[model samples]
Target: MDFRNLWPSLDLIIDAGPIIQNQGNRNGSTIVDLSVKGEYKIVRDGCAKDQTVKILKEFGLKEIHD
Candidate 1:
């Protein structure tokens, strides 16, 4: 789960658990956080979104329809 390079200059990272939460599994919320750039630069990086979703799927966070 080394996503450092994926999100370079990451500052504040908060653990969101497992991306999914329910009555049976409330402790499985995926890690989502607010990252800020150190310098005054504008960089559009899509790796974070892609990698996060991939990681969630890898961790068995299946979508439920009820």
Candidate 2:
């Protein structure tokens, strides 16, 4: 997924801290940290095939998947 287009206004923040132990299935789960909004977890499931889209929508960001 191209995050640059997905979150155009926000900058990605990478934390060098120790990886947090993820609970449950890690297959399609991703943890993203944004500059202004902090961290958000996008988990893909049967009900929600495109979790990133849902997250963007939740934050009132325009959907621009690449």
Candidate 3:
């Protein structure tokens, strides 16, 4: 099935944990925890920055961190 355009149509709760430690390097090198809840639960760790930025851009969601 074609599901590329499918987007959630429910209330979503997103939570992000603080940076725990630096993973050696200084280029955004740290471990972070994230969770998203809607109809299902989604969890991620470490680096999801790139993908998250892309998704946000796709939805024209800028100034999110500002």
Candidate 4:
């Protein structure tokens, strides 16, 4: 209520509750760091870790563990 009171002329104020997702099975997308040559840092797993690993190996890139 305080927020609205401060901004009486506000046009939009979304709650962000309706579009939230807690979890999902499939990997949204693989995020890998390719800064080091022939090496990769698995920043995030996408389509599951197995699939992401396979792709890295195919590209002759080794995963760096941190």
Clashing pairs in 4: 27-47
Please write out the lDDT profile of model 3 over residues 1-66, one tens digit for every residue.
Answer: 864454464234333444344455223322222222211111333444544555545766542220
List, residue by residue over 19-62, the lDDT tens digit for candidate 2.
Answer: 33445433433444332343343333322235555665677764
lDDT of candidate 4 at residue 13, scale 0 to 100: 39
Better of 1 and 4 by lDDT: 4
lDDT measured at residue 6 in model 1 versus the true structure, 0 to 100: 62
Q: Who wins the lDDT comparison?
A: 4
Better candidate number, 2 or 3, judged by lDDT: 2
Rank all candidate structures by their lDDT, best first, as comma-separated numbers: 4, 2, 1, 3
Candidate 1: give the clashing pairs. Answer: 16-29, 16-30, 16-31, 17-29, 18-28, 18-29, 18-30, 19-29, 19-30
Give candidate 4 regions above 4 Å deviation: 1-24
Q: How many backbone clashes does candidate 1 have?
A: 9
- Candidate 2: RMSD to truth: 9.7
Local accuracy by lDDT, each model: 0.42, 0.44, 0.38, 0.63
Candidate 3's TM-score reads 0.31
Judged by lDDT relative to the true structure, which candidate is superior, 3 or 4? Answer: 4
lDDT of 4 by residue, 6-28 (tens): 57765433232232233555445
Q: Which stretches of candidate 3 lie over 4 Å from their true place?
A: 1-46
Model 1 off-target regions past 4 Å? 1-47, 63-66
Off by over 4 Å in 2: 1-10, 13-49
